[model samples]
Structure formats: C-alpha cells, structure tokens
Target: MPIDDFDLAIAPLKDLGGQRVWSLMISLFGDLARQEGQIIGGPVLSAIMSAMDVRPEAARVALHRLRKDKWIASEKHGRISHHSLTPEGRAQSQAASGRIYATPDDLPEHWLMVVTDDAETGPLEKAGFTTLMPRLYVGDASLPVPKDAATLPGQAVPDWMKRQLEPASLAESYAQLSDALHHVARDLAGADTLTPLQIATLRCLIVHNWRRLALKHPALPRPLIRDDWAGLVAHQRVAALLAAYPRPDLPEIATA
Candidate 1:
C-alpha cells in the first residue's frame, strides 16, 4: 500500500484513545533518539506526560498498556530501566506507516469520493457527483399519490431535487441529501449483491462526502465509511440486480 493509503487507514485511529498512547510513544522515541540515543523509564514517562498534556497517572496507564501490548520493551541497566520500541513494535509501526502511506489502488473505492468532497469550497457542495449521480425513477402511476402534490408521479428527482423547490434555503437540504447519499452508498457498499461497478460508485460517493454525512448524522463515526470492509460483499448484490434486470436492448438487438 502507498503512503497515502496508509495515512487514510490511520486517519480513523486518531479518534480512538489508543492514538494518544501511540503519539506519546512515537514522540518519546524520537526525542530519546535525538538526545541520549535511549530513554530510561522515568524520563520517558515524564516527557510523554509533558508533551501530551496528560496527567502523569494517565500517562502511566498508557505506558503500561503499551508495554502489555508488546509495542515497547524495557531492559534494566544497573538501576534504571531503559525503554525502546521492540522489534515487534518497530515492525508494527512500519506496517502502520505503510498502511498510512499506501497508494490509491490499495485504498477502497469509496476513498475516491472522500477526496473529492474535501476539495469543495461551499457550505453545501457535495463531491464526486460526477461519478455516482443519483438516478430518480418515479414509481408507476398505480402507486399511491403523495400527500404533497409537489411530489406527484412522473416527477422523480435527484437528491438535489429540493433545491428546485426551496432555492433560498437549500443549504440545509443539501446537507441532508449529501448525508442520505452517504448512507445509501455505505449500505450499498456493504450489501452482498452489489457489483464491482456499483461498489466503485458507492465508494466514490462516500469518500467525497463523508464529512457531510457525519455532520448531518452526528451519531455516525467520521471514519465509518473509510474503515469498513464489508463493502466487498456488496458486489454480489449488484450482480443479482444486473441478473434480474438485464439490459433489454441487448435481447432486442440479438433478435433483430
């Protein structure tokens, strides 16, 4: 994986408590390397607490957890215990760095959309619509009419449809629509029957507007779309949909 891709993976970890510990560990290691080439336990803990603005007790707990997890090792030199990243810790950190720095191809499809969404300048601008534009299909006339006449049959509209109805206050609607698209994309990406093409499209949508999705749905984690891997199964669902609704023109052309 490219460095960029690894960064994307680590992006989610930053929100977890483990991230604080990881940061402190890295910082202490770097400082020790620059100064004495190694850090003893007491100084390591103090530096970590001071740099992280964490309580000494909290820093101690984090250090204990890291040691327990085997991310670091300690050896006694006379009276002081010197600490450093273990071989295992070094390997894990390198692996994490690769994940954080991985190339785009190593990244899932939805990540493309996320990149797009991050570039827009407006309060309600959604990203990657060019790749995964929603298609609105009206139900047949036999379907019950909506109580709101504005939503009558033959008037199917894209997620941006609300913009036409309420132009002046469309920002709120844009936020809602962007969020709904992210939800739909996540659902489709995780489904068992979506095709590769569909998954690709969904991934594009999610990557572009994940923040909007989180903003509109505060209950969702910011990295839900980025970290989830269930999207691989959604290809099966797309295949099923394609099988159920094969292109009609192909049959007619073959017959002709």
Candidate 2:
C-alpha cells in the first residue's frame, strides 16, 4: 500500500496503553463476531489480522494466551481451526456492546445513582458507573446498584452533577475524533473502490479509536451532555463509513 493511500487522521492515540496484539484481537472479534456466537475460522481470522499488519506468529501467541485466560475456546476440523469466545468472554463483550454501539436516540430518560459511605464504590466504578464523588456513583437506570446502596431516581439534573459526569478533557477528545472522522470520510470519498485489505485496515483503526473513546465516558442524558460535545457527530460519521465499506468477503481479505 502506498503511503498516501493510508489516512492516519488520529495518528497518535495519546496516553493509551501500547496496543497489545491480544487485546486488539479481542477487540476485532468483539466488533465483528460477538453477536454471531463469536465464532471465526482460522483462515478468516488470520486474513483479517494480516490486514491490520499483525504477524501470523503473533496472532498464534495471542490466541494461545486468550484461550489460557479462558476468554476464548477453539476447535479443530481436520486441518482447519475455529475459535469462539468463552461464556465469560461473551458476557464481558456483550456488556460493553451496549456502550460502544449505543445511539443518542436510545438513551434512557431516567438514571439510577448509588450513594454509600462504604468501600464498594470501586466495584461500581469498574462496572461502568461514573464517579460523582468519593462515595457516589451515577449510572443509567439499567445499571445494577448494590443491594445495600441507596438508589436515587434522576429528575432534574443539577449543574454540579453534570460537571462531575464527564472529565474536562472528554469534550475536547470528542472534537478531535470528530475532526479525524471527517478527514477519513473525505479521503475515502475520493477513492474509487478500496481493496479488502484496505477496507479492513481502515475499519479496524476507526473502530479501535472510537471504542476507546466510547468506553471512557458514561452515557449521560441530553440535559447533562454538553451542547458543544462532538460525540454524536463522530458516531454518525463512523456509522456511515462502516456502512459504505461493509465487511469484505474472507477470500478477498486474504493476502496469501
């Protein structure tokens, strides 16, 4: 591929942990196959990974690690291989899918908040609740609150609560991603047709960057969301690009 053909709009994802081969593999499968029993054949998996510049040996190692960690399971049919997420892995991925693929129109009207003076707040934060304060966590109504914690129903969102809902830098990050998405869109529009490898590469990068941002912020209601926030625009552009470059056939993505 020529240097000009590739668009690294979001060239450097800052402050993120180095992209691990195993983690990227998990993200790929979660994006592509989580709904379809998370099953993928060896050749197809390899082809997609290769499109993203992953080495075959590195993929093999990552697959082994995922299986050992109980995140994935594999089966063999003669000489060919197939892999699927383990039950535990599917549950984790499904939980995250709600956030990653969520639309503004689908947001709930009410929210649930758990306030306690105990040490259970750590678990709540890990489970996707946004920290309103030291012992306070706010989440959508669907979020599960601890049995002993007091649940508060959202009525009118206060300014203080909205301020605490998102980090100061989050809005800026959304603007940056929106800009990057626009660049990618314009670049893709000029192309006649993208090869399967090119399509795979572009999709993977977009998904990876978007996924990180999506998971970083809690799902706040319109009243709480900042007027200048660019998340909605970024998501809309990403959806359109993904639609235009639908996943290519396995054979077309294969390099060997």
Candidate 3:
C-alpha cells in the first residue's frame, strides 16, 4: 500500500529514541548536506523535519544549537536561512561518514589482540581496539598495531569476550533498530515514489540510528561477530535501503 502519511510509515524509527532535535539535525545535515558548499535552505530543512513530525520551534532551537556549537554556519538570503557544515564540522562529518556508510564487506578477516599496558591503552584505543577489560584490547588487524605488544590472531571470539564487545543494552538496541529497518524497507517497497523532502527525511532517520549503533560497535573479525548479530543484519539492511533511496541533491530537495 502507498504511504498516505509518511509519519505513520516511519513511526518505529521516530519512536526508537527520544529524537534529540539537535542530534537529528546533525544527522540530517550530515546525510543530506555535508558536502562543501552544500546548503539546506530553511524551508527545505523545515519540510523534512515536519515530515518527520519535528515541531517548527524544536527544529529552530536545534539549528541554533548547531550554530552555537560551530557545527553549522548559516546565512540569511532574504527571509530564508541556508545552513551548511562548517569546515571543522565538515571534517568531523566526513570522518563519521566512513563508519555510517560502511558496508558489511568491510568486516575484517582476522582480529588482532593486545594485552596493553597503561600507556599502551591510549594508543590501542586510538587504533580502534575494544577493551574487554583493563589492558585487554581487540581490534581489526588491518589497522596499525603498536610495538612492545604481544598480539594474537583470532578467528572467533568466545562467549565471554563477545559479551564484552556486544553488551546486552547494545545488542538490544541493535535488535530494535533492525526490526525498525525491516519495517521501513517493507514500507518503502510498497509505497509510492517519495518526494525529495520525504526521501531526505527518511534517509536521515535511518542513518542517524545506524550511526548511533555502528559507532559504538567494536571493530572485529567476521568470525568474532555473532552469526545472528542484529547489528550485522541491520548493517546489511541499511546498506540496501540507502542504495534503494539514493541521496537527492541539496538544490533538488530545497526547491521541492
């Protein structure tokens, strides 16, 4: 069936969290308008937020917060305000995009482990290690590893270690997001063609939630990841859906 009201179709996504306005705005800008010179005009931004059921005043306040935080810069051309990521903000967004849009194919083949020391902890953490406990770190073998460390190669992780990597709360969140994503995929599959604004809003909501989960997930080998890991399933679904609803240009969305 066609989606008569976009909000109802995406209720699972909207209800996934508290819908922090500023954070949602960040995801909106990051997903839709983070490129250099890309601008999301006030009306287009407003339309997307409104379609997602965000209140006008809440969006305004979130914009204000982004401006204050130096994550976004705005210009007033006539009565409309156009916003784009700041240089620093753009760089930050770009860094995050690596994770947010990464595919399941990027999962590492072998995981490297290090029994890190106090000083080594900082470097290991920087190198993307998941600390199972004090001075115990595991990360992708593809990334740089430090000297003076006895590293081990692992094809699979034990339940005890997996518990540390995939905490109960994180797994639950992933499962919930996965269910919501399947809902969206089904909804979009049968729905009528979406407007630029509608497409942008839906993409942002999915990316926002995926970003939250993906960023927190430990970088690990394919074998280390659970066979039924919801996060992995969610990752696949997100990738497919994003491909299905390709991003629209800023101008197209703004003019719509």
Candidate 4:
C-alpha cells in the first residue's frame, strides 16, 4: 500500500530513538531497500553507518536491536538477507503517525487536572479551591504562596513578601502555570469536544514552554485578574461536555 501522510511523518522514527538516530536509521533502511532488493551483512551496514557519520559497530548494534524488537523481519536469500516490516511493525509505524501527526481534533474529550495548593486539603476541596480561588478570595490573599510555611520570612505581609521575593522567579512560575492552564483548557474542551490526545499534547506543550513563560511574568500574583475563577469554571464546563461524549479506546501510541 502507498504510504499515508501520517505514516510518512513518523517514518523516520521507526527505530525509536532521538531525532538524529531515527533519521539515520530511516535513511539507511530506505537506501538499502531501494538500491538492492534486500540488505544483508557487514558491507551494506558499513556503508549506511558511513553515510550517517556513525561507527559501523553502532549501526550493527542498532540493526540487531531493531530485528530483536521485531521492527524488521529478515529472510536469508542465498548469501544476502532481505528485511521487511512485519504486520506488527507496520501497525507500529501507523500508530506513531497517529500520535505525532493527528491533530487535537482527532482526540476525544477528557481532561486530567493537576491541582496544587499551599495548604493540605481534601481532594474535593482542592478541586473546588482551584476552581474558585480567584472570585471567592479577596485581593492578594488569592495569590499562590510557597507551600513551605518555614519559607515565609515573617508575618507574611504582602509588601514585605514582595521585597524579600525573587520577582523574576515568581513571574516565571505564574506564567508557566497560566500557559499550562491555557493548554489544558484547549485539550480538555475538545476539537468539537476534548480528546485525550489533544489534552496530552497541550500538557506536553505546557512543560516544554514553561521556563520561557515563567521568565516573562516573574513575581506576578496568581490570577492577575480578579475574575480568574470564571475561566476555571469555563474549563470545568468544557470538561463536563467532553465527558458526555462516548469514550474511544485510547490509542497505543498515546501512552508515554
């Protein structure tokens, strides 16, 4: 069958390592398959290694690992061994494409919320507090504080707290949290309704961009806006809507 666009997107990753190694493996496989009907033994492997600027032994090890993992199947034809993807290998390639190429629209609605608070509270209370922190609380009191009480310099006066604080670090942390919430909302709410894959991608994006966002908004009080709880409620509503949708089998590629 002709390769699908999604398959092509994940083709370079079949060996399942870092981008460079994956690309090299894909390239070598393509070259060998195209030049000869099959690939076998040291010479072909050595040429692939040279092309990739990796050692021959490294290439041999990678090839052996791919074979052992059942990513490729081989048959001895005379002195040469021909290798091709097994049905499982083809399925794996397709799955990788679904994971890396499918947009949030392809995912289903369901969200995982991670709530953190400075105080120890019941799970239900924590959920409610995260949802209502901005509107229910007054002024700066709604702001997130260090969880460690011992870290408090004194009586916890806001002005004194500001002076003692690292404004840059604070802003960075708040920005990181805001960015994470934005993604969670996007993925949990759905393309039409939230999908797990979308949620996961959003979560991943949050982790990836966290440091930069944090640096940009250091020391800013949580919920810089008094109406921040409204957004959280909106998020909750979206999650509920997604929950109403029928759940699909979580795709294997989505794990980890």
Backbone clashes under 3 angstroms, per model: 30, 0, 0, 13
> What TM-score do all the candidates reach, one by one?
0.30, 0.72, 0.92, 0.28
Report the lDDT tens digits of candidate 3 across residue range 1-256: 2346677788889889747889898898899888898888888988888878889999989989889999999999999888899998899999889888877887777777777556445667767887777877888888777676778876556776765576566878889999999988887777778887788988999999998877764566676677677888888889998989899988888676
List of clashing residue pairs for candidate 2: none
The candidate that achieves the highest lDDT relative to the unseen native structure = 3
**Model 2 agreement with the true structure over 1-256: per-residue lDDT tens digits:** 3434653422433222335778777777676667645467788788667656679999999999999999889999998898888888888888888777666656666777778768655688776677888788777788777787898877777766676576676667777777877877876676667776667666766667678778776666565655445876777776777778786654466542
Residue runs of model 1 more than 4 Å from their true location after superposition: 1-19, 26-41, 99-256
Provide C-alpha RMSD values for all models, in order.
21.5, 4.2, 2.1, 16.0
In candidate 1, what are the lDDT values of residues 127-171, reduced to their tens digit? 112112223212223333324222322222343532222223334
lDDT values for all models: 0.36, 0.71, 0.82, 0.36
Residue 96 of model 3 has an lDDT of 88
Residue runs of model 4 more than 4 Å from their true location after superposition: 1-48, 101-256
Model 1 — which ten-residue stretch has the worst lDDT? 217-226
Task: Name the 10 consecutive residues with the lowest summed lDDT in model 2.
Answer: 9-18
> Which candidate's TM-score is highest?
3
- The CA lDDT at 117 in model 4 is 40
Model 4 lDDT at residue 150: 22
Ranking, TM-score, top scorer first: 3, 2, 1, 4
lDDT of 4 by residue, 107-222 (tens): 32221222344334444233222222312212223334334322121222344333333333444344334444444444434334334333322222322233223222222233
Error in Å for residue 51 of model 4 = 1.8
